[model samples]
Target: MSDRHFSHEVWLSKLRDHLTEERYAARTSRQCIAVARHFLRCLDKQKVDVSTAQPASVEAYLQQTRRMYRRRHGHPTDYKGWQCLHTNGIHMLLRLVQGLWPPAPKAVTPVEILQSEMRGEYAQWMAGQRGLAPGTVSHRCCEAGRLLDWLGERATREELATLTHLDVDGYLKYRAAAVGRRSLKDVTTKIRSFLRWLYMTERTSRDLSSTVIAPMLYAFESIPSALRSGDVEKILAATRQDCTQKGIRDYAILMLISKYGIRSGEIATLRLDDVDWRQEVIRIRHSKTGAISYLPLLPEVGEAVLKYLQDSRPKTSFREIFIRACAPYRPFRCGSSLYRLVRHRLEAANVITTGKRGPHAFRHARAVSMLRATVSVKDIGDLLGHRAADSTLVYLKLATEDLRAVALEIPTGVKA
Candidate 1:
């Protein structure tokens, strides 16, 4: 494409036409317009006449707009709608600029091009080769995308080849500030995995494996204490009183959480076949590790699940164990439904808590109960289908007194 200056109106019109012709989602089109308008405003402020500006100038304009957006709205805590605005906006601006600039020889590093190709290949590998759950693949792809975005203008193949440990360190530090240490660790790990794949493919010479570190073992200090027994009773009672199918479904979901310690995501993805009455187990498919596992169903949990399934569950083609009780019924899309279910129950029960009342609290409560019952940590890990014993060790902290009781007695008076 040849570089040609277009008026702001002309560019905006083109963007609109492109968006309309592409039949982009309403939300996407709105965001594209927002981004285009912001780009125009930036050009006006910089006194860079669009007609006179070169392709490089257009690139600079995009960077300036990104800085302005960050300054105005601040770095997003979560990559929800607003964050989408800034990122998608920049992408749209790039398209608009490229349209005007036509074809130009853009300098790019071999490493950067390889990384791009590797990312696509890796995503496909994850989905097709690894047979990973969709959510798992999505998460890994998101992490890779974030790292590439952070690379920004420096994402050239040559730059990647010359990347130092300090560059990785800086990336981690940026992530720590942007989100948290845990998130930084997650993204870093994903990047490291991608880099490892590239190395095996002979894309680069450096191993750099030693530089990658797993995220620190942050304690589960945030888990809320179990609600009082009375509050639990009240929540249960409130659930029983409501005659609606939704009420029954919510009640049963909460019961499963309180009794079995199932993760909300697992519960959301539950299927009719997951419940085996004869075996007295509930199969949890596509759990956190993308593996299926089973939990022995307690009588109460089994009864509640049966009640919900038989009388309350909406009739739908969705094979999910749980479905929305509302009209045009749909299966629960995410764990957030379970969270909302628990939150509503908490409010109804008049239970007050300092932090968020999510479905995970019930999981914590069950862990505590098991710990208090003198269940071994290893066994607990097995029951929870934890890949590592350390994953279930958080219950140890919550069960401080129990651990104290089981502590080996040391002879204090005699010195070894």
Candidate 2:
């Protein structure tokens, strides 16, 4: 067959060969082939000659194909789904066209050019221009990519320019319904940040950042009284005298939570230098507020931690206070470790576990106990390293009696 009249099977075979030769994963190759086949079938249904297809023809074919697919599938054909079906088909098509007609000087469309340019520019700006934290940059890039993916098989920069507040709202609502509230909130925040970047960089004419703000859920007054002091005491007592490395580490973690109201993340990030034996204070660095605060070391908490550090903690070069107890032991890198430790202890103690009873529960418990003891809200906020007094005020919910005392009193036996 002439190159211009290459059959559907021939083009598909070439596409499959390209995917395999590029070392695409097995699943990816299958998906790419599927998308290519679909696109070719779409061309056939439109009676378009694939061999004579130009860039404009390709664009028109994609639009008609999307409408057809939506009519058949009852939903618009999303670019992500199409891309997944034939991984990087657009990029491959561009390359293939250039290769087949080297001297032709293939026409470059604005949308195609913009997508390519924006991707590289956004990545570079996120890394060097914004100097965002590595994790933050990664998250924002992923979110932006998702938005592009939603634009479907022929997304363009102009379409992005035309996006309205309603579009953003719909996207957020779709995400919330698809995933969960927390994930929706996270992705929305990332999108908002990206929009801000776009506005600052003059990528868009109008600022769309104001259209998307994560709604405030409720304020946390105190840790939910998920488990009572009795239950916590029981869990700790069960660990008494076990003396295993895991047990020692867990006990120490629990003690700190109960006594200091220290966040699990704070405990995981604790360093050797954080403890000041002379001053009896533990400095918590890089807390949620990105500020450091010191808490006086209680004798019980200090002793528990010292015991674990010396006796149970695996010897490692890691500067963090805690480390994994198992083989190939590594420093405790995040709050999840502390949560697992608490969970295991709770299971061992036979306490019925409930909503997120990680090390933070101990923090909540401490805050509630302190409030019950009439500790000032300001002092509680300081101790907890909370930047705002309102954050600490959540403990008032736990202190029902305190609130009741200040409420208006009823007159004795007055008839209505």
Model 1 error, position 254 (Å): 0.7
Query: How far in Å is the alpha carbon of 231 misplaced in model 1?
Result: 3.9
Q: lDDT for every model? A: 0.71, 0.73
The residue ranges of model 1 lying beyond 4 angstroms of the native Cα positions read 1-116, 125-137, 198-205, 213-215, 218-230, 276-286, 289-299, 375-383, 386-390, 401-416
For candidate 2, the per-residue lDDT at 162 reads 73
How well does candidate 1 match the true structure in TM-score terms?
0.61
Number of the top TM-score candidate: 2
Give one digit per residue, the lDDT tens place, for model 2 in 33-131.
Answer: 776666666666667765655566556656776777898999876788673444356446435644652234332776546655665577788889778
Per-candidate TM equals 0.61, 0.64
Error in Å for residue 17 of model 2 = 40
The superposed Cα distance between candidate 2 and the true structure at residue 230, in angstroms, equals 1.7
